[model samples]
Target chain A: MALVLQTVDLQKRFGGIVATNDVSLSIEKGARHALIGPNGAGKTTVINLLTGVLRPTGGRILLEGEDITDLEAHKRVHLGIARTFQINQLFPDLTPLETIGLAVSERLGMGGQWWRLVGSKSAVVEQAVEVLDRFHLADVMHERTATLPYGKQRLVEIALAIACRPNVLLLDEPAAGVPEAERHDILAAVAALPKDVTVLLIEHDMDLVFSFADRISVLVNGELFVEGAPEDVARDPRVKAVYLGEEADA
Target chain B: MMAAEESGDASRTLVAQANAALAARARWSPLEIAFWLAAAASIFLFPTKHLILTEIAILGLFALSLDLLLGYAGIVSLGHAAFFGFGAYAAGLLAKYHVVNEPVLALLASGIATMLLGFVTSFLVLRGSDLTRLMVTLGVALVLREIANRLEITGGADGLQGIVMDPILGRFSFDIYGHVAYVYSLIMLFALFLVARRIVNSPFGLSLRSLKGNPLRAAAIGIHVNGRLVAIYTIAAGYAGIAGALLTQTTQFASLSVLDFERSADVLLILIIGGTGYLYGGLIGAVLFKLMQDWLANLTPQYWQFWIGLILVIIVLVGRDRITRTTDPIRALVQRATDRVWSGVRGSG
Candidate 1:
């Protein structure tokens, strides 16, 4: 299998504390890869490093063979890499329609045009509508995003990423804070994404993770602790011990 | 399965309605049209008030420039008068030296010149928090004022002198009755207003609002945050410069006071009093501000400003959220009507 994203000994440190250790990770093309770790395993930190939100202290990130370690966050997005925040970073005052339209327009290279209204471009609006429909956000398409239910807000976050048509989409806790009723929609929407675009999900929900991921990479203290098929990882004694130990500690 | 199919169809209908509704909202409404109509009528309707009306027009344009930066982009600038003063001086020197004889051309030249200054200085304001930005912008204005005060060409504290504006379009001479000046200012205001309207409603403007709401998220969606900021700041500077040029072209003079602190403060006040975000806020604010100043001066010449300051405090204390809550329904109603009408047309077509 071809690797779509690979990191060679990526490292980050805050003073003396290591946030992301010398952890080399790879995501194969068309792979539904899930990155799982307990609290403070640096899962979010890894996502941030990959997306250029935080500069890595050492090593390199390769996206389809190109070194992207030095790229800016926005530039990284343009280079076929997109991400959703763990805490749902969104434009509160903007409607879901406008939000998706902006993402579509930005990708279509109309973001810089001050002379053209958002509705002036049929392609942008149509693509935006399609994104809203796919994520089941059409019902609340015109409402202020801040006023949305947490579940819908999470859905909008992922919809925005999908609108960019990225080659690799990183979802950080897509089901986090979503209601029990809305959880099914989020998981189904994620599973129904197009096959060509690889997904790397950072999640805490084992049910969703085991159900969705073909490959599971468990992280522990900013390092890769285990990697295998979901069933293999699930049955592995070491992986089971890690969780049981954490349970005992808690 | 049937329920799912029905919901899918419902989603399609909603999205389709959204497409039509979006187009309708972007179109000009009757209230906006009436507002402009009244602005145009004022020149003829209040012929004797042309002088004050001219000032209102200039002030309105200046406030519009600020609205782009503060309201749309969320870039708080305490020294926006820098461009206005620079434009005023540029036009004054052009007219004084007979370098550019035509007023409109000279206005364009002044605007372009100040745009260059704004572009260069844009970087200074780019890498900062709000407090840092405030200091840097204020510093730029103060430095410009000092330079204008020191320069021989600017006539030092006396300001640039001997400015002569030829008739607009080479025919209409500026009259003492403030006839041509008011017409010229009004026309300039409307022309720029339309351009600003187009910009704020555009995709780029949407991106700007996104930046204002969340810069980190805007960047995540592939928006170059700093790049967007620099672009808006430069455009706003050009607009302010054009407004300044209008003042120089009409009054036939430019002075040190044009670049002073009060100019910046007053424009900020105008924007705050009227509200921001929408382009009309600046124009409406200018009218209210200028009229209030006029009437208040007539009634309480010594303490007019005291009352103005008190009104601003009252507005702030009473809160913008409370104010908008009361008026939002009217806006929502209009938007809903526009959508219905637009969908009706689309359905027929």
Candidate 2:
């Protein structure tokens, strides 16, 4: 697989603390990559650095072999980088359809047209409906996203990110706070995404990580401890000693 | 298997219906048409009310501009009247010096000048939170007021004088009855209201609303948050400047009162009274505020302010949701009637 995203010694320091220290990562095209570690292992910090939410102390980020370290967050998004937050960051007052519609319209560069009604754009609305259908959110498409159940809101968040039609997507804990019974919805949604889009999933659920990730990278204390196939990482003593521990089977 | 297929078909139908409903919601409702018609008819119904009506139009435009910032863009400005007063002075000075005697031309010039000022100051407003923005905007207004008070060109504290506007379009002179002023201001208000209506209904408006809901998510979704704010702020300033120019042309004078703290506070109160987020809130609020001022001030000439304050307190205590809730049934009733009529037309055709 060709490399779609690369980080070169990404470093982030908050005062005396090194939040992200000398981390390097690469995501291949069509790769279902997972980043897992113990608590405060800088999993989210690295995702933030990739999404341009936090500036790296000293490093370079390359998207499709082009340097993008200096780009702003929205500019990064325009460059086909999309992310979902650990916490649902959504417009509570807008319905799922409206939210998704906005993303689609923005992707199409029609987000700035002030003279025409957004609904009148049938192509955009159709695309939004299609995206909503993929997430199984068609039934509650008109209901305000905030009023939806927590699991469903997470699904909507992913739906929104995918609506951007991104080439590289960083999902930060998509299944966080979701109940067990509803976790399958998120799992199914992730599994259904197009294969050509590169996905980097940050997760704490070991079962989900093991099952979904083609490749797993273990991080300990803001540094990559090991990276390999899920099975190899699962059995590796170094990953178990520092992070996975004896819970590898469970 | 049969049940699953049926449910799938039902959901598809539901999605289609929901999309249609969303589109319908953006169109002009019967209530909006009725309200505008009644407003337009009022010009002829109460000929003696021209002066007050003209005042409402000007004040309505001013409130609408603030709504675009505070309601849609989530930018709370405490000194919007700074632009209003500046435009008033710009128009006043131009006409007083015979620099631009044409009313429309003067209005445009003044509006552009104030828009430039807003563009310059938008950077400062964008740098802070709500409280910080309030202080900065208020400080700017205060500074401008003091400058106006000290400057000889602004006639210092005495205000600009000896200003005369050429007949509107060189055809109709502004009369004491305010006939031309009323028509002129109403025309300007309607034209600008159409522009505002178009903007708020468009994708740009939706993006602004998203920003207002959550700036972080807006940016995460590829919206340049600060850029949208600055653009709306500049456009809003132009609208407000035109409103101020209307007042200056109608009254043939620009007074220091235009820049007063009370002016900004009053417009804010008017917007809240009418509600926000919707463009009509300003127009409705201006009508209610000016009419209440007219009635209450006469009833209690000494303490009208107390009554206005009491009303605001009641509005707050009652809550905006409850107020709208009470009217929901009536609105639904009207909606049903309109739907019936529309279906009848479709069926007959």
Candidate 3:
């Protein structure tokens, strides 16, 4: 499979503490890859590094064989790396339609057109509406996005990433804080994503990880402890021991 | 997904509805037109009060500039008067030297001059906390005020005097009654108001609102956050400069007081009174603020400021949102009545 995103010996240090150790990862194009780790396993940090939110102290990042380590965060997005936050980082005042419209306009390179009205371009509105409809956000699209239920807000987050038309989509805990009833809708939406777009799902839910990922990379203490198919990783004793031991400690 | 034929029909309906909603919002409502008409009528209705009306128009434009930064982009500056003073000085120098003595061209040049200042100082505001931005902006204004105070050409502490504005369009000399000044300032205010309205309603303006909502998310979604802020800041600077030029042109003088802290504070207070976000806030606030200031000063010349402070405290205690909410029903009622009257006229026609 063609590789889309790769990190080489990535490291991040805060004062004396190591947040991300000498870690390397590769995400294959069109692969449903899940990055699973415990609460402090540096999963979110990895997402931040890939999206250029946090610069790696030591290491290089590559996108489609390009050295994107030094690229700006928004430029990384322009180069087709889009991410959702672990916690929803959304415009509280913007409606879902506007939120999605902004992404679509930015993607279309019409973001700097100060003279054009918001709905002057029908293509943006069409795509924004399409993405909202796809994520089942059409009914409540007119309301402020923050007022929506957590599940729908999460869906809006995903829809924002999708509207950017990214080559590699990073979903940081798409189901986090979602009600159980609304979570299956998220799963359905996640599963129905376009086949060509590569997805890197950072999730704590084993059900989501197992059911969705074709390839699973288990992280333990900022290190890649296991990498294999879902079944193989599921069968691995180390992965089970870490979870069961943590469960026992709890 | 629904079947091909059905989904296409549904999506089409959706698209049309969205377009209609957006178009309606972007359309010029009758109320907005009526507001401008009323503003225009004030010139004729209170012809003897043109001097104060001119001041109100200038103050409104200045307030609009601040709203562009604070309301849309969430960049608050306590030193916005820097641009105003820069423009004031630029205009005074231009007119005093007879370099581009025509008022409109000089006004544009003054705007460009302030835009340069804004562009340079915008970088300083980009990296700091709000407090840092505030101090930096205030410092800029203070520094300029000091520079103007020390300069020979600017007339130092006594202010630039003997500046002459050319009769607008080679005719209509600025009469002593201030008719020309009020009309000229009002026209500029109206023109600039249209531009600001268009900008705040545009895609770029949407990006600006996003910046205020969440800068991090704005960047994550491919918005160059700093770039957007700088652009808006620079534009607002240009607007403030034009407003400053109006003060210079109408008064035929530029003073060190143009860059004073109170000017910045007064514009901020005007925005608070008018509300922000909506473009009309500045204009409405300017009217209320100038009128209140006029009335209070007449009532108690020695302590009008104290009363203004009390009024602001009352406004804050009652809450801006609650005030708007209380007026919502009245606004809706007017909107409905206007809509019916408009439809009736169209139907009869």
Candidate 4:
């Protein structure tokens, strides 16, 4: 499979401390890739660099063979790259349906047409309803996003990113705040997405990472420790010592 | 299924009507549109009302200019009067000394001068938070006022007088009765409103709205947040300048009153009363404010300001947003009935 996004020799530093050091990684088109590390291992920094939220000290970001190192975050979004935050970034005053409508409107380049508002567009409204329904959010579609339960909020954020119809989707700790009961539903929704969309997930739950990731990359102290298929990486003693503890293995 | 479908159809019809009504209200109600049109119509019909209406028109345009930045772009300024005063003084000085023979050219010069001033002041606005921004803008206006006071050529504390606007288009004389002046001011105000409305509905305006709603989100989405704000500020300043020039052209005078804190406060109060983010809000506020002033002064000339302040406080206490909230259901019913009647007329046609 052709690679869709690849980072070459990425480096970032804060004062004297290096956050990401020469981290080279590639995400194959349509592959489900997971990046995992202990807290402060700079997994989020990698996501930030790729999404143009933060500039790297040194590195190149290649999207579909074109280097997009200096691109702004919004331009990257327009170029078919979208990322959900570790914390939800939703329009709190807007309903779930309204939030989705804004995203879809932006994706379709109709955001500028105030006279052609989102509520007036039947097709866009129906599509927003379908997206909310996919995550069992139809009941609360008209409810403010801030009023939804935490798990549902997380689901809505994911739904918003997906609604962009992006070729590549980035999810940062999508299940971090989710409850045990809803985790299955969340996983099923993620798994059921169209096969053409590539995903880069940052997840801490070992069972989730192992089951969902087509390939796993382990980061340690701002460096890549190892990357391989989930089973082989699970077997690696270094990964277990650093990422998967004895309790996790048991 | 039949009952559910019937209700769905009913609600859809209700919603479509509500949507249309809301759109109309958002554009300002038909009554307001008719009122302005009627007022414009009367400028020709009633010669006596022309001068007062022209002042109203100029002030309304000034208030609208402030609303463009304050209401839509979310840039609060306590010193917009700086641009107004500058434009008034520019056009007044030009006309007094016969530097410009053409009134339109003088008006144009006044606007361009104020835009240059705005371009310089925009950098100050870019670096400050909202509170800081307010103070800085106020400081800029105060400084400009002081400079005007120091310069004898600008009439200093006495204010510039005897501003003889050259014949508009080299034809209509600005008489003491203000017939030509009123027409000139109305035409200018209408043009500014059209331009303001067009800009507010444009792509740039949408970006400004997005920036207002969430700056961080706007930045993430690739909007140059600061750049958009500075550009909007400059445009609003240009409008303010034109409003100032119109005032001088109508009054045959330019005064320190244009730069006073009361002018800014009055505009702010008008925006609050009429509504914000809606184009008509500023114009409506101006008419309501000036008419109330006239009526109150007639009743209690000494305590008119006190009564106006009380009205403003009541408006703020009631929650401005709640006061302006759409009562869509009732309006929607009437709108649908009207729609049917219109379609019937079209059918006959």
Candidate 5:
């Protein structure tokens, strides 16, 4: 498969702290990839570097073979790289429908049209509704996103990212803080995403990572410690010693 | 296959309802229609009240401009009067020097000048959080006020006087009765309000609301945050400039008070009274504020400030949401009715 995104020797340092150190990654087209590690392993820093939220101290980022290391966050989103926050970052007053509608309209380049009502753009609103329905948020589609349950807000955040019609999506802990009962809903929604879009999921939940990721990359101490098919990574002794530990043997 | 058809029908119903809700928000509600009609009818109902009415109209426009920044874009500014004073001085200088005697043309010139100022200072305002923005904006206004005070052409603190405006459109003179001035300011208010209304209902407005809600997410979703702020700030400055020009043109004078810090604080208070985010807030707030000021001044001319301050204190104590709570009954009725219709349609489907 063609590589959709790649980072070469990505490094970020804050003072004496090495947040992301000499990390290199490749995401292939339509790949179900997971980046897993223990706490403080620099998974989110890597995601931020990829999404242009934080500039890499030294590295190169390429999207579809074009260098995008110097691009702004919005510019990267415009280039079809979209991401969701580990903690839900949503407009408190806007409904899920309006939030997603704004994303869709923005993606379509109709966000600057001041003469027409947003509702008048039927195609954009329909697409937003479809995306929301896919996340099973159709019932509370018009309710304020901040008032929704934490899991549902997580779904809305992902829905917003997907509304951009991105070529590559980076989901940072989609199930974090979600109740155990609602974790399955998030998993199912993510699993049902179309395979034409490449996905990079950074998650701590091993069950979700094992079940959803076709290929897994384990990060230990801000470096890529191992990469393989899910079963192979599960069986790898080094990954076990560093991340999975005794759980891998079980 | 049957289940699929049912679900499709249900989804369609939901979409229709969503579209209807969006449409409802986009247009003027019945309350807004009533407000406009009452305002229009007041010209005849209170023929002697033109002077105060003109003041209300101009001040309303000023408050509306601030609302666009503070309410919609979430940019809190304490020096919005810089644009207002710039417009007033620009118009006054033009008329005093015979640069432009045409009222409409002078207003336009003043608006553009102040808009340029807004564009330049917007970078400064956008650089920091609310506190930094407040200090920066306040600093800008104070600096401009000192410049106007020390300048010769600005009348050196006495203000630019003898601003002789020609007949508006070569027709209606600004008579002592203030009929023409009242109508002129009212027309400008209605026209600009339409523009603001159109903007807030559009996609640009939605994007602004999104930014105000969460700038990080807005940027993550492809909104050029700083660019949007700069554009709206410039546009709002132009609106405020026009309001100041109206005051200068009608009153035939531009004074240092135009740039006073009180002007900025007063407009901010006006918006708080009316509630922000919506365009009508400024207009309604102006009406209530001016009428209360008139009544209180008559009752206690020397201590009216005390009463106005008290009212503001009450508003803050009660919370801004309480101002809108009185209208909740109507909003709830409409929402409940819509919900029933949607549920009914879904159940049948």
Candidate 6:
């Protein structure tokens, strides 16, 4: 399989504090890869670096074999990379459909035309509705996204990422604030993404990770601990001592 | 998952095509179109004195320039009057010393001169937040006023005089009827409005709106937010300069008070009364504010400011949005009645 993305010795330091340290990883095309780590292990930082939100103190990132380390986040998005935040980053006043439609327009490289009520454009609105529907958000298409429940908000955020039509999607803790009852639904929706779309997911729940991810990379104290198939990683003694100890209690 | 993906892709494609079609058919918003039409009609239709119409047109253009920066670009400036005053002085000096004979050259000189000044100060203004930006703009205006006062060439407090604006387009000299001045101002106002409208409707304008809503998100989406803001701010300064030049040419004088805080305050008040982000709001607000002041001052000379102050207080107390919604309740009722009558006629036909 062709590798879609690779990070080479990525490092980020805030004075003496190392947020990310010599981290290197590769994502195969169309594969569901998981990045698992404890708190402060820099999972979100990694996402930021990949999406161009934060610059690395050292190292390089390659998308389709072209280095994009110096690219701005939005430019990276146009290059077929998109991400969702751990916290919902949405236009609070806009409808979910409108939010998605704006993303679609950006992805398609349309001029602003914002004052022109492009919201009524059937193709754009239809695309927005389709993404919403995939996440079961049709009824709330016209409703302000801020009014949606936490779980639904997460789904809408995901829909926005999908609206970009990026070749690689980075999901930062899709189930972070989700209620237990709605957690399964979130996992199932993410697991259902198109096979051609590569996903790099940062999830805390071992159950969701093991069931959904094809491969898992463990991180401890800003360093790579181990990486392998879920079953082997689960059985690894070091993994048990660190990640599994917390999982057993959950 | 497969079913959801299929539906999502299909709907996305459908929405894109539908949006493109709808966008193609959409016209300018009712508020904007109605405003310009009404303004144009009133200019030709109203029985006001010619000089007053001239003042209205000049003031309207000035307010519109401020609106471009504050309303559309989200740059809250309190010193825009400095550019206006600078343009007036520049044009007046040019005309006073026989530096330029043609009105068009004076106008271009005024605009380009202030634009260069704006470009120099834009870096300082662009680095600050709203409050800081306001202060920087106000500071610049203050400095310009002081400089004008100090310079003998600018005529100190006596103002720049002997500004005989040569015949516009080499015809229709400004006369006692104020016909040429009024018509010239009106045409320039209309032209500026068209350019402002075009700029605000373009991709660049949309980027401004996005930046206003969320700068971080805009940057994340690949926008060079700071560069765009600086460029727009400078463009707005150029508009302000032209407005100043128009006033000086039409009136044949440039006063130090043009750069005064009162001028800036009036522009801000006009924007507030009319609404922000709507191009025509500036014109409507200027006309209404000026009319109110003109009428009120004549009625109660000593208490004119007091009455106006009270009106502003009432507006703020009642809340701008709510008061705006209620401003034309009576007119709205009349409109509804007229609509029903028209529909009844059509139905009978």
- The TM-scores, one per candidate, come to 0.95, 0.93, 0.97, 0.76, 0.93, 0.80
What CAPRI-style quality would you assign to candidate 4?
acceptable
Q: Which candidate tops TM-score? A: 3
lDDT of 2 by residue, A1-250 (tens): 7899999999999999998888889889999999999888899999889988899999999999999998988889999999999999999988898899889888888887888986878778888888888888988888888899988898899899999889998999998998887788778877877899899999988888988999999888888889999999989988778764535645
**Cα TM-score of candidate 4:** 0.76
User: By DockQ, is 2 or 4 better?
Assistant: 2
Residue-level lDDT for B140 in candidate 5: 93
Regions of candidate 2 where Cα sits further than 4 Å from its true position: A179-182, A244-250, B1-19, B343-349
lDDT of 3 by residue, B1-349 (tens): 5599899998888888777566555667777999999999998899999999999999999999999999999899899899998999999999999998889899999999999989998999998789998899999999999999898999998999999889888886898899999999999999999999899889999999997999899999999999998999999999999999999999999999999999998898889899988888888999999899889999999999999999999998998999999999988887777667766777999
- Writing each residue's lDDT as its tens digit, candidate 4 over A135-199 gives 87766776777789888888887888878777888889888888988877778888998898899
Give the range of the ten consecutive residues with the poorest summed lDDT in model 2 chain A.
Answer: A241-250
Candidate 1 error regions (>4 Å): A236-238, B1-15, B333-349
Judged by DockQ cut-offs, the docking class of candidate 5 is medium
List where candidate 3 sits over 4 angstroms from the true fold. Answer: B1-3, B334-349
Model 2: reference contacts kept, as a fraction: 0.71
lDDT of 2 at A6: 96
- Tens-place lDDT per residue, model 1, B41-158, is 8977999999989999999999999999999999988899999999999999999999998888999999999999999999999887999998999999999999999999999988
The TM-score of predicted model 3 comes to: 0.97
lDDT of 6 by residue, A107-204 (tens): 66663453344554455566666777777777676677678887888888777787778789898888889888777776677677789899999988
Across B1-349, the per-residue lDDT of candidate 5 in tens digits comes to 9999998998788788789778767655556677788888888899899999999999999999999998999999888899999999999999999898889999999999999999999999887899999999899999999999999999978999877889988988899999989989999999899999999889999899999989989999999889899989999999999999999998999999999999989899999999899887898899999999999999999999999999999999999877568778977886666567665767999
Quantify all predictions' global Cα lDDT against the true fold. 0.90, 0.89, 0.90, 0.81, 0.89, 0.79
Interface RMSD values for all candidates = 1.3, 1.6, 0.8, 4.8, 0.9, 4.4
> Each candidate's fnat, in order?
0.81, 0.71, 0.83, 0.16, 0.79, 0.30
Instruction: Put down candidate 3 lDDT per residue, A49-146, tens digits, no spaces.
Output: 99989988999999999999989899999999899998899999999999999999999999988998989999999999998888888888888887
Clashes of each: 0, 0, 0, 1, 0, 18
DockQ of 1: 0.71
Better of 5 and 6 by lDDT: 5
In the range B1-349, model 4's lDDT, one tens digit per residue, is: 9998985675455445433432332243345467678868877688887777787888898889889998788898888899999998988988999988688889988998898888889989886689998999899999999999889998889999877777998998888888888888888888778777767755466566667776655555445667778788888898889889888877889888888877877787888888788678888888899889989999998999899889889989987767656545655666666667655767999
